[model samples]
Target chain A: MIINARYIAFWGCTIPALQPYVEKAARLVFGELGITLAEPEGMTCCPDPDITHMASHEYWLITAARNLALAERRGLDLMTPCNGCFFTFTEAISELKRNGKKANAVLSENFNMTFKGKVRVYHALEVLYDVVGPENIKAKFTRSLNGLRVTIHPGCKLLKYEEKRLDVKLYELTKLTGSTILTYGLERLCCGVPLMYLDADKAIELRTKPKLDRMKEVNPDAIVVICPACHNQLEKGQLMISEDEEYDIPVISLLELLALCMGFSPDDIGMYLHRIPADDALEKLGLI
Target chain B: MNEIHPLRKRFRSLPSSFKGLLRSELRIGHIYELTDLTVSDREDLGLPSKPPTAYSDPNALEALKRIAKATNLKKDTGFDVDKLDFEW
Candidate 1:
């Protein structure tokens, strides 16, 4: 048997503070796959790549490099469940390498740190679908989500980077859980999380509502997302729009859904953490 | 010298499920080369990057261009020695 590849779990800021349940479910799934996820000490924000990258390129690179330096210290790559965090780390590394000597020089002089550009970064979906094959992961499913139907809102950062690869991995793994992926027209839309930084109202209108309206048609058991920011935006975004009976679909993390298939009871992963609880999904999957 | 898998040349290995298995280590920046290990042992020992060729993330590049254009900075410019200069 191939020993699982070890990695530093980069939880970013949201998952720990807002969605501890994601961290919990991800830990459970990682254990089942024989993957070793180490949480490095002294880690800070992925620092909001969308803003930092826009506001100050230098600070963004420096902050992201500090996180990368932490993983390099352990001789391991970083794995993140949040698309924004993954984009910050991976994009920072990609930018840093373009002018390796200069970026390294800046780090050594200002922060007294060196970025060897060796450490790699991956989104949680990438690790699940790529490192752990879909079949291998499917084999670990003790119980199946037999009748469940899901609609996924893949966050924009991942779409901007590796849409084709991320898209393939997501459905393949979702199918492995024995659930049907309900198709929606705006499945590719942003969660409006980034827009919240610029325009709260417009972000809600352009990002969440239209997509949620489309998602309603499939009448999915749940809306699953691989990005924590999306998880927060979609759920909280739903609440911000309107509390009417017209719009009330629960949003969940991809790890939580996979955990259900892997024989975890909904209560175990803290489904209550969701802004809109997973009661319908849980009851549908017969876990209740 | 070993050969880079024709499919992996563009990082598009067929049977998507098997593509991730073929490469030794998936590096975002470095170019990958052929593996010397037997087909069975290949996945065991990650294929290493020798020439260390660097590549850009298209999304990041495109976004950075927008950031640069909005900020009135050169699109290709990033952190450099000029930003690091400090005097005691």
Candidate 2:
């Protein structure tokens, strides 16, 4: 199937450092699906860090409006895979839509430009869901993720704002690939990564650990993550917690994991970048 | 017993005074209480049961306020305080 859309593949800083593998895997999968992704010039941070830090609401809006303006200038829809970026961008759009005159006036004054409301923000997963279509995705699977239990972490941004718009449950995605999807009570929980910059220990103890505990009780083989923040927090947070108790489930990007079962190699999908190591999990599936 | 106000019921259910303050700080234009959220509920709401390491910072209250405002939950649904029991 061919889906044509020019997208600004906004990485928002974290992708290169902690999630290169995710970008690589996405490129491979999306390339095969015939979707084009490009990085627009003059793009800035999604204003998430500033907004979450409680910066002035006007300042946050100005910053995010600038990013949207950049995307609009290029006539491309902004597609972000990072949860924080998605939240920040989507929230900005929501706010502007709610207060159109004030939002546009701020843009006109600060950036000397008008926000014509031309850009549409989308998470990368939505693109994948659309192009791959669950049924076709199932057909692409070379190996079944059958018998392997997994917990899907939807992350805060994926579910909090307009959750119905994004396919967070991913039941269709998993079922299409011949895997059994098990969602625990914490399935919709935040991984507490945002609090990491503030309180590593507490974010771990309360936000991260509980989800791990829930997942452990179910004894899932791995935790599948959609947001990079959740992926980093859950994976590294578990490793830190593992020092006190044996925590062994591999944390994987949903894209990389799906690529593996679809017969792609670690090299093909850039699995080498993972800090928690997918080798054991790979060996289990005999992909190594 | 009389039917309790959603706000008062939520306030009584919190495990700590600090959480009550957090609930209060976040309440703003809406009403919120501890009973409206369990630990899992808090997680779902993107508010953690255990304060993040940054919880000690004086800025946390402000951050939470920003989050609340950005999400536009200040007027609708109030905080569902009864969900905090952690039974789930």
Score every model by TM-score: 0.74, 0.71
The DockQ assigned to candidate 1 is 0.02
Model 1 chain B scores worst on lDDT over the 10 consecutive residues at: B22-31
Tens-digit per-residue lDDT, A42-67, candidate 2: 55445554222252455456556767
Q: What DockQ does every candidate get? A: 0.02, 0.02
Over B1-88, each residue of candidate 2 has an lDDT whose tens digit, in order, gives 3366544433222233323323443432111222432333334323334222122233433433443344433233233333321221
Off by over 4 Å in 1: B1-88
Residue pairs in clash, model 1: B24-B46, B24-B47
Give per-residue CA lDDT, model 1, range B20-64, as digits (tens). 211111222111222332222322222111111111233322332
Docking class of 2: incorrect
Indicate the residue-level lDDT of A85 in model 1: 82
Please state the error at residue A101 of candidate 2 in Å: 4.9
- Model number with the top DockQ: 2
Highest lDDT: give the candidate number: 1
Give residue A50's error in model 2 in angstroms: 7.2
User: What's the true lDDT of residue A150 in model 1?
Assistant: 88
**A1-288 in candidate 1: lDDT tens per residue?**
354689988776566556667777888889889999886455545557765465456645765776687689889999988888888887788887886565566556655678888999988888888788887888888998878888988878878876547866777777778888999989788878767766788988887888998998878888878888788888887788775535678877779878888888776776765778778778887788
